[model samples]
Each structure stands twice: as structure tokens, then as C-alpha cells.
Target: MSGPIRLWVAVKHGVDVVLARADRSTGTVAMDRAPRKTSDFDRNAVEEAVRIREKLGGTVTALTVGPPTSKEALRDALALGADEAVLITDPARPDLDGRGVARALAAYARTHPGFDLWFFGEGSTDHFTGTIGPRVAAEIGAPSLSYARRVSVEDGAVLVEREYEHELEKVRAAFPAIITVGQEINQPRVPTFMSTLKASKKEIRSFGPSELGVQPSDWAPLARRDRVFVPEVNRKRQAVSGADPATTARGLVDALRREGVLP
Candidate 1:
């Protein structure tokens, strides 16, 4: 609290929902072929971390756990204004589930401590479980402030405003806290050409399971994904043909009523 704030933000390189396509034959998604990008909510978290650093005079370090390709997300974070980036990866296990991810992050903290604040998105874009932030907080024995719409530091403590469906809650906690932010907190800044170039030049420190003291059991996934597919939606191809507009409207109303879409 007395020294410069050490802000750490976690990001994910997840599948791009908009670009991912389902297989026509199997009806399952082709995850291997799908394009990947930084998670949307994580971008907001990075922006907020950068803003806080700019205001409070601190450093923002972006960290990620994924395959080697996850370095792309770190580069994006650096371009967005993070001071540095760290990537935790395992070539043997490219895909890590939520539990494994949390364990790896916790191990990082144990090896490299002295973090004042940690930020995470409410959830990843691909799998919106909203569990990573809380899990990490619990693992590190830090206070978790989830679903933060606004955050600030005052009197050596962190203040958070949590937004709910019909109500809002204000929470305060000491330093070394974890905050998961939503998109409503702030709009993420777009990286300019120069920033992108600079980010590309910055070296992203890489760590593997061995380096982080992660054992085989620790890296083992807690849950398995059976399959991913888009649900099929059938449409009624009924024709409401009529000579007059009034008749057509009446027919449409009748159809809606029969379908229980109208009361």
C-alpha cells in the first residue's frame, strides 16, 4: 500500500465465437481449426488495470496460461498499455481446464510474490463459467471482489462496486485482492500501429510446469469436454397467403397463437 501498486491481470486466448463454425456433417464445432483471439471481458480488465496504473503510478503485468499461441494475447495486452507480460504454458498439455489454470497461477504467485492487486475478467469468451478469478483468489488466500463494475483504491484498501440485476453492492477489502471485471466497467482501447510494433518487440517471459513447480496431477484437467456443437433450430415454413392484408394479418396471429407464442 505504501509502495507502487503491482497490478497483475490475467488474460485468455480463447476461440473467437463469431468466427468459429460448426461442422455441417458432424454438427460439432471444429475447435482446432477455429480462429482465436483475446477474450472480450479480459480486454476490459486489461484496460482498467492500465488506467489504474496510469493514475496511481504503478506497473501492469499481464499473465496468461495456455498453449504457446497464447503469447498473442499477451502481446495485445502490452499494446493496450501493460508494462510487461508473462505466459505460463505446457507443451505436453496445451489445453488446461479451469482447475489446472488456477493451480498454475497460484504456483506463479508462490514463486514470484509481492503482488498488490490482481484482475481478471468475469469469464472467458469461449467458456463463460466465471470461476477462474474466485478460484485463484481462494488459492492465493486473497479477498475476491467479483463482478466489479467500478473499482478504486483508497486508504490502503480497494473499493469495488458490484452490479446486479436490480441492485448494486459496495464492497471494500485490503490490499492483495482479486477483482473480476465486466465489460460495462470501461471500453478497452484499440492498439495503434506503433504500440503493436512496440509490443511485438517486448519479450514475453515463458514458464512451463517444471518452472512453476506444477506436477502432473496439478496440470491434470479437472473436467473434460465431451463435445461442442450448435443447437439445431427448426423453423415452420407455413404460408399465410391471403388476398387482403387484413386476412394475412389474421392468419399470422392465428399461427402465433397456435404456436403458443402469443397469449
Candidate 2:
């Protein structure tokens, strides 16, 4: 690009999946029971954006939509290399669906024009919906590439490779577009002690829907959680004991057949 590109990366804070709990009684996923952190895929997206800024000479802005507590994710992004962070939070926005999140992001993009690129993870690790990037792009009337496993920028055009069920799909699109990166893109760099210290002092901008001229009625219905429950595990096994090699071989074959490993 001729001018300095302003890159924006969208991230989300979710319950650490390792510690998340499903409240069967209330049929809701409870994040309060577990510690929270930035979504893993989003971290990769941030890393990719950072790399792009470093190579192309630009600024990286990390954006997130969530409750006030989501500032933690923003701070983490700052520690990772984002130049600035923005958090869109409001109580009325509770349970904001993919469309609502996209609308908010589109509003932000409209307010801050001239951004050469926008980046996002292929999908949040927790939800795995993988729809926000395209939805946001549609709302903003911008081009977008999703599930990009590899990416390159050259002479104002962006090239990307997306993973398909049985093949790799390639695409070339101009800048001022949105791209959602897959985990295969690159490993996220860990924050150094110095970076963390600096991030502590970095200012994070916060805003509400009203500031973006968004109305609650404009948002689509939030996704509902009818019920949440831990899955039950069942296992059956039988030991075949024998001293003769031939007998053991025959027994093993029978066991395999019984288990449907062989027909």
C-alpha cells in the first residue's frame, strides 16, 4: 500500500475451556465458574496482524465486543503488540449474537475510515461459529476472506489460502478488506515481561452502542442456550488371557471383530 495501513484485529474473551462448566439446571454455559482469557484463535489473528504491521509499516488496533470484563482480553492484545485497543460494552448488549457483534464492528469501521485491513480469527475457540468476519464485512460493504490459513500482502493486494474439506483454496483480494485467519497461519508470540509492564500503562478505549449510533432494536435476536449438560462416557472392555501364541492370535481376532474393528 502507498500509505500507512491501519490494521484492526477483533478478539474475544471467553471462559477458559479447560475450566468451563455447563449448568444443567439453568441450561446455560457458566463462564463465571472459570477463569477467562483471550480466545486462542483470536490470539493467532492478533499475531498475524502484528506481523503484517511490522512488515508493512502500520498500526494495529485490537477490537473486542463484550462486557466490561472483556478489558482483560484488550490488555492481553496490547501486551502482544497491538498499538491500541477498543472495547464495545453495554448491559443492553448482553448475549449479543454474531450479527449484533458484526454490526458494532461495522459501526467502528465506519467511524474510523481509511483502514487498509481488518483481521479476525477463523472462529472463537469456545463458540466456533466462524461467521463474524463475513457478517461484519457484509455490513460494511467490504470484501472479506474467511478461514485463511496462509496470507501475503503485495503491492496493495492480499493473497490468501483457505483450507477446504479436501483441498486448499486460494484467493486474491485488494486491501481495505476483512480476513479471518485460521490457526495454521502462525504461532502467537508470547508476551515478554517488558511488554506486559508496558501494557499495564497502555490506555484502552471503551465505548457503548449509543456512541456508535447503534440501537438495540437494530440488533438481531441473541442466540439462546436452551440447556447445557456434560456428556456421559461409556466404555466396555474384555481382557483375553492365553499362553499359546496361536490361541492368543485367534482370540485377538475375535475381540477385534466383536468390537467392530474388523468385519
Instruction: List TM-scores for all candidates, in order.
Output: 0.91, 0.87
Model 1, position 13, has a per-residue lDDT of: 94
TM-score, model 1 to reference: 0.91
**Best candidate per TM-score, number?**
1
- Every candidate's CA RMSD: 2.6, 3.2
lDDT of 2: 0.85
lDDT of 2 by residue, 1-263 (tens): 67788889999887688778667575456654556789999999999989988998889999998788888899999999999999987687655777778888888788877777799998887778899999999999989999898888878888988998898889989988899998888999999999998988999898887888878677656676554556755666667767898898899999889879997
lDDT of 1: 0.93
Per-residue accuracy of model 1 over 1-263 as CA lDDT, tens digit each:
77899999999999999999998998999786689999999999999999998998889999999898999999999999999999999888887899999989999988999888899999999999999999998998999999999999886789999988899999999998999999999999999999999999998999998988778578698797889999997977788978899999998999899989999
Output the lDDT of residue 131, model 2.
Answer: 92
Which clashing pairs does model 2 show?
none
